[model samples]
Target: MDKTLRRWAPLFVVPALICFIIAFLVPMIMGLVLSFFKFSTVTDGVFVGWSNYKRIFTDMDFISSLWMNVRFTIVTVFTINIFAFFLALLLTRGVKGTNVYRTIFFMPNLIGGIVLGWIWLLIINGILLPKGVTIISDPKYGFWGLVALANWQNIGYMMVIYIAGIQTINRDLIEAAQIDGANSWIRLKSVILPSVMPAITICTFLTLTSGFKIFDQNLALTAGNPARKTEMLALNIYNTFYTRTNFEGVGQAKAVLFTILVAVIALTQLAATRQKEVEA
Candidate 1:
């Protein structure tokens, strides 16, 4: 049976592999290749070497969008993790209706991103209407709106991870710390935190990547209104691709650069967090 299963394993995987190649790998490679050429369509592509890359750097909108995305990622990552960790700690205690609360908290994550953006847009605008303003009326408002929307959606998901990590901690270790006359703060600092390092790493990575890749929310909420001030990297790439004619190569170049940027940041974050986990 084992030998038969092993023999058929490749057969079972081949279909999925083929689908992935056609759906993702092929397009990704094509996009990378197209980034070095100029064209309105694949068939008409003309080799342009590094011109597309040069145009990407010179585009002020792209530069601003990249910076905005970086800022949003940093802010959202910290806010979401901190809040989620605290909520996890709370619910893991003797709290009543924890299951209900968990369900309620996590429901936001179940909503589609575009829908979430529109919902927040209405809610935020309703609040700001009293002050005679709207979310898209200013870049700062749009920035904070995206931050708030991201935190609301992600905090609950991160909380679940934290709870699982907290539950895995040895109660005996915590009791041992208490017996040594360690206060709650001391125990939390020296034991509970270290025990939850894995969860922290996972949550941070998710938040970081999600924050950086934000697009639907930015689009539904602001669509880079008031002169593209609130545009993020993903949305900027999107606009460059469709909104401007004959700039598809530049857009593709921006996308390749965006992919590299996200890869580097995520790898750096994982390395740093994994080191902390080992130390802890």
Candidate 2:
């Protein structure tokens, strides 16, 4: 039976492998190739070498968008994880209606990003209208709006993961800490945190990547208004691709670079956090 199953495994895998190559691998390879060329279309592409890369760095909007995304990622990752962890801790306690509270918190994540963006747009505008400001009226407003939206959508999901992690911790370990003259703070710091380091690592990684790659929310919320001050790296690439008729190649180049940047950051974060998990 083992020999027969092993022989059939390659046949079962072949179709999925072919689909993967066609759906993802081919486009990815083509995108990489096209990044080095100047063209509005694949058929009309002209090999331009590093000029696209050069333009990406020289363009002030691209640089600004990149920095904005970095800032947003940093803020969102830290805030979301901290808030979620605390919420998870609270919910895991012997609180009434904890399941209902979890469901309520998580409902926002089930909403589509585009719908969420629009909903927040109206809600924020309603609040700011009284204050004589709007999300698109200024970059600062847009930035805060994005942060709020991200926190609302992601915190609950992260909380769920954290709750699972907290529950998995051995009850005796916590009891032992308590009996060892450890206060609540000490027990939390030395016992609970170390045991849940894996969950922290996972949550951090998810938030980092999601925050960096955010596009639909950025688009529907601000559309990079007020001279594109609120533009993020994803939106910048999109505008370069479709909005500017002559810069498709540059846009593709930006996308390729953005992909590389995200890959590097995510891998570094994972490696660092994984090391912490191992140590813990």
- Candidate 1 per-residue lDDT, tens place, 241-270, comes to 999999999999999998998999788987
**What is candidate 2's CA lDDT for residue 12?**
87
Q: Mark the regions of model 2 whose C-alpha exceeds 4 Å error after superposition.
A: 1-11, 273-280
Deviating ranges (above 4 Å) for candidate 1: 1-10, 269-280
lDDT of 2 by residue, 1-280 (tens): 8888888987888999999999999989999999999888787889999999998888999999988999999999999999999999899887999999999988899988898899889988987998898777888889989999999999999999999999999999989988889998998899889888889878988998898899999999889887999899989999999999889889999999989989998889868987876776
For model 2, give the 10-residue run with minimal summed lDDT.
Answer: 271-280
lDDT of each: 0.91, 0.91
lDDT of candidate 1 at residue 149, scale 0 to 100: 94
Model 1 TM-score on a 0 to 1 scale: 0.93
* RMSD versus native structure for model 1: 2.0
